[model samples]
Target: MTDDVTAAPRIVVGVDGSDPSKAALWWAVREAGLIGGVVEAVAVWEYPTAWYGWTPPQAEVFDYEKNARRTLVESIDRAIGPDRPVEIHTRVVQGHPAAVLLDAARGARLLVVGNRGHGGFAQALLGSVGQHCAQHASCPVVIVRGPGEASND
Candidate 1:
């Protein structure tokens, strides 16, 4: 971590509005409070590709960002409640989940994420987001698991 007092220590966390992601957010908040760092909650979104060569309306296409931001806020509220003591900054980025999280983790002390997300492969131990961030993030990565989730490693 940077020792510069001018900058607030930051811990970046990737959130996908999933249960494990919410747990990761809460864990990050607690760690931030312990270390005097602020938590950066990042939610990534992109316009869905249309099937059968059909395109959605422009308004509908742009609504994903708004929904992502809403989801991030709700996750934060659910995890830490409205009167959280630690400072939390929320971001909605447009790109792949791992790429967006890596960008956000550039200057962070730690990058945190959930073990799995809303992907179809629910039985997997780790989802692509967690695996990618752990492998490629600039800072150290912490993969938070839910209460009932056990580590296979």
Candidate 2:
């Protein structure tokens, strides 16, 4: 295991408004506080587009970024409480969740994620986004599994 003293590790956590993810966020915040590092809360959202075979409305439509930002903040507030010593940063990206998280993990000292999310069956068998990060991230990855959620892999 890499010693925590090697660097004041920056923790990246992926939140998708799921109970397990909430637990992950809570864990990340506590771990970041313990390590005296910052937490980057990331949410990946993709707007419906031609690639997905969805037609765009003529008028200006929904603001996915704004909504994602709000969700990230709300999740952090719900998990870490309103006032905490941990520094939290929110980022919303447009792409696949696992890919985006892996890219974000490049500069992060550690990547943290839940064992499962809103994604159901595929994630369960594949070990979710946390497992993907653990396998591919440049930095260390931590998988925070929630209580009562059986390990499928």
Candidate 3:
């Protein structure tokens, strides 16, 4: 019989520099190891709406994309450590987090995201991005929950 697992599946995971998101990354790595799949770590960057009215001096300006890329790398290093066997591809996109994750998940075997993000609404059990992807992603979605969090349903 031909080995059906010959093809390596692609798993798209969202990272937002949050603890929960890092947990999701580690979970994705473990899952990829089991399925012999590759992980596409996608990090989205955009200036906060509050920054629309203010522009810093040229030297004081921030590089949002560069910061996002650094965050992604640090999260991966902290989560997966330096010795990992699975293939991981990192991507830094500019757009809404949910929209970016959904777009990246196209043609992917699975989509994984953290239950919450680094936002002010700490009371919110499910972050907007995770909720959106769970409801709208094309492939199977996995929302990794951090400690002390329980699913509503």
Candidate 4:
């Protein structure tokens, strides 16, 4: 009888240049290594002027997709080591973070995200993106809480 090994499940994690997102990236790498699966680091960045009340003369001025993609790739490369065999992919989309992350989860076995993001209230609210992803992602979601997350008494 021949023994067959099943490939590890694919994992998707969202990153937005925040401390919590960085923590999630680190956690995702470790988990991916343990499971022998690759990690997809996703960053969702839309044209900044669209929702900020600034009408740019040229749409390209606020287009952050390329920069965001590069940031994610570089960050993953640095964190996972240059020679490691871990497979990582980077994607940048123009849309809401939650929607983008949820869509990416369609083919993934697991979705990982930070408990907080760069846009939420500093005191007591979980980031809207994380909250939405946790509630609606197609796969199991893992929310990596940051150091600033408070513990319940």
| Cα shift from native, residue 23, model 4 (Å) | 0.7
Better of 1 and 4 by TM-score: 1
* lDDT for each residue of candidate 1 in 7-76, tens digit (9 for 90 to 100): 7789999888898999999999999999999999999997766887576557433678889999998989
- Tell how far residue 113 is off in model 1, in angstroms: 0.3
Model 2 stretches with alpha carbons more than 4 Å out: 1-7, 49-60, 122-127, 150-153
Candidate 3, 1-153: lDDT as tens digits? 445456689999999889889999999999999998999999999875646666445657788999999999999999999998799999999998999999999989899998899975887888999999999999999989876676789
Backbone clash tally (model 3): 0
Q: Report the Cα lDDT for residue 7, model 2.
A: 58
TM per candidate comes to 0.87, 0.79, 0.87, 0.80
What lDDT is reached at residue 63 by model 4? 38
After superposing candidate 4 on the true structure, give the runs of residues whose Cα lies further than 4 Å from its correct spot. 1-7, 50-63, 81-85, 148-150
Provide the overall lDDT of each model, using Cα atoms, as 2-decimal numbers. 0.88, 0.82, 0.90, 0.80
With a 3 Å backbone cut-off (N, CA, C), the pairs that clash in candidate 4 are: none
Q: How far is candidate 3 from the true structure (C-alpha RMSD, Å)?
A: 3.3
Report the poorest 10 consecutive residues by lDDT, candidate 4.
1-10
Among the numbered candidates, top lDDT falls to: 3
Candidate 1 residue-wise lDDT at 52: 72
In order of lDDT, best first, we have 3, 1, 2, 4
TM-score order of candidates, best first? Answer: 1, 3, 4, 2
